[model samples]
Target: MTAPDLEQRADHIVEQIDRFVADGKRVVLSSSFQTQSLPLLHLVSRSRGVTVYFLDTGYHFPETLEFRDQVTEQLGLDVVSLHSATTKAAQVGPHGHLLFAEDPDYCCYLNKTAPMETVAAASDIWISGVRRDQSETRRQLDEFVVRSDGTTRYHPMLDWTEPMIADYQERHDLPRHPLDDRGYVSIGCAPCTRNIPGSDRGGRWFGMEKTECGLHVDLVR
Candidate 1:
């Protein structure tokens, strides 16, 4: 879709969110505060009372954590921080040291997905910043979806492109993730993430085939 088209779609999405809020639905936004996440964060910030969920995986770069806090404070967001039941040290006891290297998927399940499942159990709507252009796995996702758990998963920026995101951030003066300046396009857990050229998600899970952290994939199940 063109930039104009995506902007129109974004407007419609905000309207839908407003309507959901008016109807007293429990709406929440899940954000990673990555390079492309600011636009969606800005969008949801405009709607009062929508709680933003940030998965505190305990392994994220210090820069990411700082940026998350900056965005929360700057936007005055109603943010809810989520963390795994197991501590990193405790997880290592059972899964072995460097569990992310041994089994990234399972590690993600423990840290990311499990916390989100708890959030999904209580939320009626889940707003996310996922865009089709980010990865092949996300390309097939619909802008609006009904999860198996009965929560409505809404992707307000599903049709957006990198240029659109840059434009929106510039227009709104939204803060960029600090790691983005260092060429880290897709920021996540520090150990599993790196700098890769061209692709936005190329840095994620570096050598492995894993693209998504289980949060997006498992939330529907």
Candidate 2:
């Protein structure tokens, strides 16, 4: 889509978010604080008391945590950091060490998906910064979708391309994720993430066939 087309789509999503809030629906925006996240965060923060959920997998890069703090403070966001039930020590004690290396899927299930499931139960709607151009798996996603549990997900930037995102961020003067300059296009946990140029998700789960970290997969399934 053209830049203007993407802008219009973003406006529509903000309108939908406003409508949902006005109608008294509980809504939460899930963000990874990646390169594309700030625009969505800025859009939702326009409405008061909208919770922005960030998954704290404990394995995240220090730069990601710092970026999260910066954006939350800069936007005055109503942010909630979700974490796994098991502590890093507890997880490693029983499961051996580096669960992500041994079983990335299950590691993600325990760290990311489980916490989000709790958030999903408490909220009527979930908003995310997922874009179609990011990956082949994401290309099938719709602008609006209803999950099996009845929570509606809104992908405001589903049609947005990298240029569109860059345009929006530059227009708003949004801060880029620190890792972005270091070639980390898609930042996840530190162990599984790498620096891969020219591919949005090539940096994620580098050599594995794993595309998603179970959160999106479990939600859509």
Each model's TM-score?
Answer: 0.92, 0.93
Which one wins on lDDT?
A: 2
Report backbone clashes per prediction: 0, 0
The 10-residue segment of model 2 with minimum total lDDT is 89-98
How do the residues 53-158 of candidate 2 rate in per-residue lDDT, one tens digit apiece? Answer: 9999998899999999999999899999999997776565345776787778878988999999899878898888788888877888887889878998877878
**Deviation (Å) of 156 in candidate 1:** 1.3
Per-candidate RMSD, Å: 2.1, 1.9
CA lDDT, every prediction? 0.82, 0.84
Error of 1 at 39 (Å): 0.5
Q: Candidate 1's residue-wise lDDT over 1-221, tens digit each?
A: 55677678668778889999999999998888886888888878778969998888888899988888898899889887889898777676354676786777878888888898888879899988888888777888887888877999988788788888888778668888887777777888898988896668888888888878876774332
lDDT of 2: 0.84
TM-score of 2: 0.93
